[model samples]
Target chain A: MRTEGATVAFLDIEKVVFTYPGRAPVVDGVDWRMQAGEFHCLLGRSGCGKTTLLKLAAGLLKPQSGRIVLRGGELAAPGPQVGFMFQAPTLLDWLSALDNVLLPVSLQRRPTPQDAQRALRLLDQLGLASHAQHHPRQLSGGQQSRVALARALVLEPPLLLLDEPFAALDAITRAELQDDLLRTCRERGTTVLFVTHDINEAVYLGDRIALMHGGRIVENWTITLPAPRMQAMRHGPAFNDYCARVRAAMDGAGT
Target chain B: MNPTPMQARLLAAALFLVLLGLWELVVRQWGLSALVLPAPSAVAQALWSGLASGYFWPHVRATLQALFLGLAAGSIVGLLAGMALAESELLERVLKPYVVVSQVVPKLALAPLFVLWFGFGMLPTVLITALICFFPLMENTLTGLRQTDAQRLQLFRMLGATRLQTLLRLKLPMGLPPSLRGCAWPWCWRWSASSWPSSWVRAKAWAPWSSPPRA
Candidate 1:
């Protein structure tokens, strides 16, 4: 993908602080920003508040201090512009794949003929067209995750937040989904803020990677690698170097 | 081809007849009196004549009417009470004690009160049945609703569903199986009410020396 005109800021997080009651801040004094059409990954250990940061951006949680602005609008609550894929697929087990994909629009009371077509197109794009009539329990884990991805994207949201979306899958399925997600997000120009603990995944998919520890972003690295990233890239020197740097940063932060 | 449940039931019935024949032979050899123990054949004759003459139909219909009306009223009230209690902690706290007390109180004692209130017709019978039926339905529905997966609830919130929408779409669907199970027992109770009284009288006739009339 070309990098031209992708420098415009799409989301800005400024001096955000959040804490559970009677506890230390889970996200403390964090400042971060993402550019339009960029694939960013928040890499951190468990309980490091990477998911908390994603929740804040998704407007699922409010920061006690500082501001979160999305597309120049202040993030207040969940809206149609932002989509979220939780760690679990969270597909309604009773709903068929097609209905699950159409849930965001249906919940918003905006499902029209165009929205139905869009849902079908999304299922096809995710290679799930044939399974549209199947329930979530009848689908494999990989298929369920794909359906969830379709649900998140069917509304044509500009911003997508994924909280360890592939953490439950096997390595082979995870790799396949990682590549599919990268290609799809790149083609759609969707600004993705994804959370993951895997260093290799952060390096493979992130255009810019942020390492978070103890509720703060300790390091941020931008990958200047060419698009159409392949598995062979993992063996390349630049990818290895980036992984090593991220690992060192994680170790230094004692996370 | 799969054997139909009806075929299975017929096979069970044949086995039951064989057992009944052996019991009749043993009783005849011991010279059991007709008043003390009417044979299975006699009972069958009574049942058939009762059916052919339509003498049982009115009683059967009356009992069924009471059972069905009671079931419907009990289920609806139980479902609404469970949902309302689920929505408000204060209501649960204030009304839970009364619900528990009602379950613990014997229905035989409560039956007279219902008869006094509604009089000696279907109303008293239906009211008694409903009182007997409500506890299981309410408890099961409440448990099912309260136990909905928290992760799923969070997903609904993230999807921007209102609280009512979440309850209707997610929680209600999840509670359906348990609620249906709770509703099943009223059917069994209906059948028992038809058969148990006659069966108890038959047993008493076989034990003739038990007790004389008090007055």
Candidate 2:
């Protein structure tokens, strides 16, 4: 693979390896890189270590070997510059939508007037400004996910990590959030490393899809489809070709 | 079924009236001595006089003082103990047996011992009240603290919250309502009565005086 220093590549993962205590290595020597403002997806079956790799990249898990560099600096503990959205909404049920979005700010104990204004603006952008006072229980699954997304993005982190965030939503809601997430990330020029098992979703959302099998990345394909991809892209030749390649890669690896 | 406040009050009043009428009828029909079984009217008169003479205030005050003191002490100790146990498994293992034994021992039996150790006045009463009050607060607070959602804890850790921050912001808040409920109002009332000596003043002062005047 050619190593080009593009202005876009924000994260570099070189020969990363991880193994749980008393267990075999879940992620063994994976080399992956993504550009700045890129939406990359890790696609695989369950237990393929896609989630584990995402955690490693987010600094939630330390790699036993190799290194992950974020903007040229070694990734350490999760900081304000990196936002993580878990599989669950992970919203504090007692807190209002606005308060949930402000949690990281409160934890850091550094919310300026501008930060508050930014939070409000982000909620507004996410279509949750009117539901600021509502609790997580009051919102639908889609709305809750949106609020979670708003919370994740409110801090304006350069790197956003999503772990199967929309896996729990219904089909229609998932599709809607997919589009919303794509638009939001693109507008902010945020680099997103998303993990999902859905092949269609991987192609639909990811600018580059990396297929993982047995804790290793066997294929990394970059999608060159046009910007603002529509649902019709799924029926196009490019989308079909990417899907076929990824499927073959997965099957070839006996995943 | 949940009764409305008005319905509950009406039911209580009807029960009180029925009990009073039955007592009155039994005493009248049996021609019992006033000393043995005072008429409902006589008891009411005595009660009124006791109230009017301001004899009940001092006892009420003493009882309330004991109750408040015991409640404050018990709640503080219980909360601290519960939090400590929740935070440390070694401490929990060492103390769990003693806590169970203390809770099981009859409080009334221990009352005299408390009096013997602490002496008369409000100390024994407050100690007894605290003993009675501690169990619920400890149990409830401990349960609440332990019942914290694991996912929430993980989320807090992921958000870079320290252990103390997680406890204070998440576990403690989650446990508060149950802890408050555990310290029921009835326990407060009992503690008040035990701690305050005022409730006994009217009974003790008037009992001797109620006998027929010397010839």
Candidate 3:
């Protein structure tokens, strides 16, 4: 969960519509706004276009019509300003963990020594310092996800877009990673748009949650639970209440 | 029960010795000419004399030079062509048929034509060897480049990577292992290629003694 901050719109998606070739609109007339430093989750069922919308925001896909503005300018193409995490970790199997984290920098030019140090620091922050030299094949699913997270955050982008990054991990590992992600993003004040189908996960990590159904956002909630979300909070009545509300909204959308 | 490693080794050694003895006896009894089938003992003796006199060194050097030079040239050309074809659809469509036809015609068949054009010595041999070595590496490299993970490509796109950066950083590195496997084809072909030139063209200093071919 993000701490309270001044209400400044960091990303503005207004009536954004996107349809694949010979297919119906996957993201249709979607309007969304996020304040700077917000941790927002796009909660949805499968094929609901939440992932499509996230991709559109990341500039990986273009909308059929509508403007996606970031920091008061059009976001026509992906740049260093937006960090992205795919559904899978997507780490290069040939590269060591440290090298994978340094990819964003190395793609442009030879990485400076400071860039390497920063990548190492990010890995350390994710509890992967010792595994820096280890390749993706040597790492567990959880460790690989952490490395992907470090890679996403390496450039210290102002906006982070993640599409179910921890969906593949086991429960205990997922919880640990959620905590790590929350703490890291909060420290950096990186505006996050996290997409997930897991209601509990959405409640646990988001400052605000938007329920997307049939390529449109059907419900939005500003989570009222106290800040500094803890593992214990998942079991609390407040958290369950939020999850229930989101679940009801989802069910309503299905009907 | 499976034989122990030492037992296996001894068994293999005994089999080899028995075969060699059979070969020696058959040749002697049948009055076989050396040209028809040289005895195993004769082969061993020749090997010993050749090495002992250092008569084989220059031939070995020549064969090695052709093998290495042809391999290096063939592989570099194949890799570059593969990169170009993989990057451009129009180029692949236009050049791929010619490339395929070139490979379809046997390299051995091409050796005589090469000798006619380039004349004797290493040049014609090297050309024939390089032609033989080219195709497999190119095809493998192209397949590898095209087979890059789609998700990984998306990741690169999201990072605003330039076309060159995407090719070098993502496509090329990912394609290397398969392309290296392609080198195996050229390696095996080089041996046969090394001997073909001397048979077709004027005998180089390293040419092994052999009967002339029927016209």
Give the candidate number with the greatest TM-score: 3
Model 1: runs farther than 4 Å from truth?
A1-8, B1-38, B178-215
Query: How does residue B163 of candidate 1 score in lDDT?
Result: 71
- Candidate 2 interface RMSD, angstroms, 1 decimal: 10.4
* lDDT per residue (tens digit) for residues A69-118 in model 2: 89878988877888889899988776678878887776666456887788
For residues B3-74, write the lDDT of model 3, one tens digit per residue.
999999999999999999999999999989999999998999999999899999999999889888888888
DockQ of 1: 0.16
User: Candidate 1 on A171-237: residue-level lDDT in tens?
Assistant: 9999989988887788899999999999999999998999999999988999987888998899899
> Which TM-score does chain B of candidate 2 obtain?
0.73
Tens-digit lDDT string for candidate 3 (A37-103): 9999999999999999999998888898998999888888998899999999999887789888988
Q: After superposition, how far is residue A228 of candidate 2 from its true place, in Å?
A: 1.8
Measured with C-alpha atoms, the lDDT of residue B133 in candidate 3 is 73
**RMSD in angstroms, all models?**
14.0, 12.4, 11.6
Model 2 accuracy (lDDT, Cα): 0.84
TM score of chain A per candidate: 0.95, 0.93, 0.96
Candidate 1 achieves a global lDDT of: 0.85
Off by over 4 Å in 2: A1-9, A252-255, B1-46, B178-215
